[model samples]
Target: MKLKTSFIQLPLLFDAQRLLAEINALDASCWRDHPQKFPGNFALPLISVEGDPANDGVAGPMRPTPYLEHCPYLMQVLEKIGAVWGRSRLMKLSGHAEVKPHVDLNYYWRERVRVHVPVVTQPAVRFICGDEEVNMKAGECWLFDTWRMHRVINDAAAERIHLVADTVGSERFWNTVDRGRDPFAGSVTENWHPETFSGLASPSPPRLTYESVNFPDVMTPWELREHLLFLLDDTRPHEQLARVRQIASRFITVWQEIWAAHGDAPHAWPIYREKLDAFEQQIHRFAGELKFNSNMSFIEGMNGLIFIGALGDRRQPTATQGMRRAS
Candidate 1:
C-alpha cells in the first residue's frame, strides 16, 4: 500500500523496423480523435484482448496481436524489476502529442509499477515525474513509480512508440515469482519508504520566473515576429498568459539594467531610447491582450510582449514593410 521507486534495463534492443511496420498496420484513428487520453496519430489492435473492465466491460483487457508476441524483450525487462506478465497492459504512443501530468488513480496506494519500453523515439520525447525528467531512447526500458505525478510528451518531428505494462501484487510476490534475480539492484534505497519515495515533500511548487520561461535561441527579428504570431494564435490558459506577462516585465528590467551599465558609451543613449520605445509598445500590446489590472507587479509589460512575440515563424520577412504588414 506504499509507493516505491526502482530501476531496470531491458535485456534486448528493440527492433525498430518490425515495430514500425506493425504500428502502421493497426487502426489508430480512434486514439488520434480522443487525443487527451492517447495523443497524436498511432495504430492500435496490434494485439487481441478483452476490453477494459472498468470502461469497456465484457471484452476483458485489450491484448496485443500475435506479431508483437515476439517482443518478449519488454517482458524480460519487467521480470528484472519483479513484475508479472499477465497483470500488465500494453499502450503505444506517437509523435507531437502528450499525456498531461497526472497520478495513476487505480494503483497508486498498491505496490504496482508501470514499465515502459521505448521501441522508437526522438530526443524530444520526455517522461517527467516530479523533479525528474527522463528522456528515453529507442530500445531502452524504464520502470517508473506512477503513484506520484507523471506525464509524457513527444515534441519531436518523428513518431515514438512505447510498450506499457503494469505489475500487480507485492514486492515479495515479485521477488518470489522471479526467483534468484535481484529486482532491487541499482534502485534507490530510499524508494522503499512511501513518505520519502512518494514525492510528498519534494519541494516548494515551482516558481514561474522569467528565466524559467523558454526563449528560442539565436532568433532573428523576423523569426521573433512569427513567434509572437504563434502565441497569439494559440488559445492560452489565463494563468499562462499571466506568467508570460510577468516574464516579459522581468526581461525589460534586465534590458534597462544593461542600458544603465553602458550609459557612458557614445551611442548608448540613442540605442537605449529606440529599444525602450519598441519594448514599451510590446508591453502595451500584451497588457491589452491580458487586460492586466493596474495593481499587477511592474516590469512595464515589455518583457511579456517579447516573450509572447518571440514564438514567431522563422523565415524572415522580405522587407521591414513586410514585417509591418504581417503584424
Candidate 2:
C-alpha cells in the first residue's frame, strides 16, 4: 500500500530470541527456494493457502501451516498485529544476497500492506526503498511503501531473516500506524511506548483470521474506476493520457450499466467479458506507450489491477492465472 512516508516504524517489538528459536526449530527442508529462483533467497511459509506450505498463490482461504502451529510465540506475535493475514512467510536473504528492486505490481498487493519484523538481522542489513534506506533493528516492527521501488540487501556474512506478513490492515492496525513514526520525519517520538512480547508468557493458541475473498469474479465499476484513477495519477504525463482517460471513463459507464442490470448473476459473465475485452483493446491502442513514474508499463498495471480477474467464475475461488508475484 502507498504511504505518506517511505517507512513507518510501528510501536511494537517482539522477542527476537524466541522468534529466532522457533525459526531454528524448523527443519532445514521446510525452507523452499524463492519461487522465481533468486539465488540465496528462500522462504518458509508460515501462513499459506489451505495450510499447504508449498502453495504460494495468494488467492484462497489462507490457513496456518504446520510450521506456524509449531511456533507458539510466533502466533502471538502475529495475533498482536491485529490484521487478517494473506500470504505470509519467513523471508531469508543469505549473506551478500539482495532482493532486487521492484515495485509490488500484483493485484493482491494493490491494497495490502507488507509488514516486516526483523527477527535475525545485523546493522549491515539495509532495506532500500525509493531514495531512503534504513537498517531495521532486530524485533522492530515496520511497514514500507510497497508501491515504490524497494529492495533489501545483506552486506554481513550472516544471514538475515524477517517475518514478512501481508494484510489489508485492520482498524486496530491503522490505529497503531497513526501512532507510528515515519523515519524520514525530523523529530522522533521520544515517549513512544512499544508493546513488547516476552517469551515468559504462557502459550495459548492464537485465533487468527485469514482472508477468504481476495478477488471477485467481476470487478465492481467503483473499484475499476478507483484502479484506473490511481494508475492515471501515477502515470507519467503523456500526450495520449487524455485519450486513455476518455476510454476508461466510457468503460466504467458501460460497466455500471451492466452491473445495474445484471448485478453478479452467472448469466451476465459473458457480457462482462465482452465489455472488458473491448475496454482493454481500446485502452491499449493509445496507452501502449504509457508508463508509470516507477517505470512499470501502464497496460501491465491495468491488466493486473483491473482486467485479469475482472471476469471469472464467482462460484469458486478465483484462479491465479495472471497474478504476478508481489516481489
Candidate 3:
C-alpha cells in the first residue's frame, strides 16, 4: 500500500535508555566499512548475509551479526514486528555529514519496507523524504517510503544513530499500520517530535500533464517509472514480449536467405532458414569489416530490404474477410 506520509510511525516504541546503552556499546569499527549502496557513508550490520550490513542486496536466510548480541532487547522488538525480515543494521550519520537524496531501485525494495528505530539523535539531524523534513528522535519507531527520494543530514555536533531494518510486510505489520496515526495530516513539521503523524505525498500539489498507469489515478509519471523499474521489474516473461522476440529471431533467419538470392525472392516464401543459419557464419568471420555497426545491423538491413516485398502474396484473410464470406 502507498504510505500517507514521508514517514509512518508504527505503533511500537523502545526504551531510549536501554536501546542507547546497547548502541553506545558498539565499537567504531562496525560502522567503518564502506557502504555498498550508500557510498561514502557508514553502517553496521545487525542481521544480514555474511554479517555485512553493507551487502544490501541479499534477502535470504539472514542471521544476526556480532553487533546484535549487545541488543537482545532490540532483537526482541524485531521479533515482535512480525515481518519476514531481510536485513537489520545500525546506520550512523556523523556530525556534519549528509546522505544525498536518492530513490532506491532494486528488486528487493519493490515489495519491502525499511523500518527506522532511532537510538541516538539531535534536533539538528533532519530526515527528509521528497519535500517534507523531520528530525527522527531517539527511541522512535518509524517507517519511510524508500520508494520516494529521501535523505538525511546530521547538522548536530554529535553522530546520529538509527536502528534500521528491511522487511517485506506481514499481516501484523499492516495491522500496526492501520492503527498508526497520520502525523503529516496533523501538520507535523520540521519540529516533529514523538508527539504525532502520515502523508508522504498528500496535501502536496499534484504534478499532472503526467499520466500514471501503474497503481491507478494517483501516481505521476516519474513515480510510475520508478515503480515499474524497481517494483514491477522488466517486461520479461510477458507473452507478447516473447512473441515479439520470436518474430525478431525469425526475421533474421528469413533475411539471410533473401540476401543469397541476390536481393530477389523470386519464390513467394523465398528463404530457407537452414541456409540463412549457414550464411550467418561468414558474417561472424569478418565481424569488424562492416561499414555499419555490426553483423546484426547487416541482418537488419537484409530484413528491411525484404520487408514490404515479403508480404501480400497468398496473405491470410482477416476477420473482415470472414465476416464478408458469412454474409
Model 2 ranges off by over 4 Å: 188-190, 313-327
Q: Deviation in angstroms for 118 in model 1?
A: 0.6
The lDDT leader among the candidates is 2
For residue 20, what is the lDDT in candidate 2?
A: 93
Task: Name the weakest run of 10 consecutive residues (lDDT summed) in model 2.
Answer: 315-324
Q: Which ten residues in a row have the lowest lDDT in candidate 1?
A: 318-327
The C-alpha RMSD of each candidate to the native structure, in angstroms, is 20.4, 2.2, 19.0
Question: Candidates ranked by lDDT, best first?
Answer: 2, 3, 1
Candidate 1 off by > 4 Å: 1-3, 6-14, 25-83, 86-90, 107-109, 169-327
Judge candidate 2 against the unseen true structure and give its global Cα lDDT, from 0 to 1: 0.85
**TM-score comparison, 1 vs 3, better candidate:** 3
TM match of model 1 to true structure: 0.41
C-alpha RMSD between model 2 and the true structure: 2.2
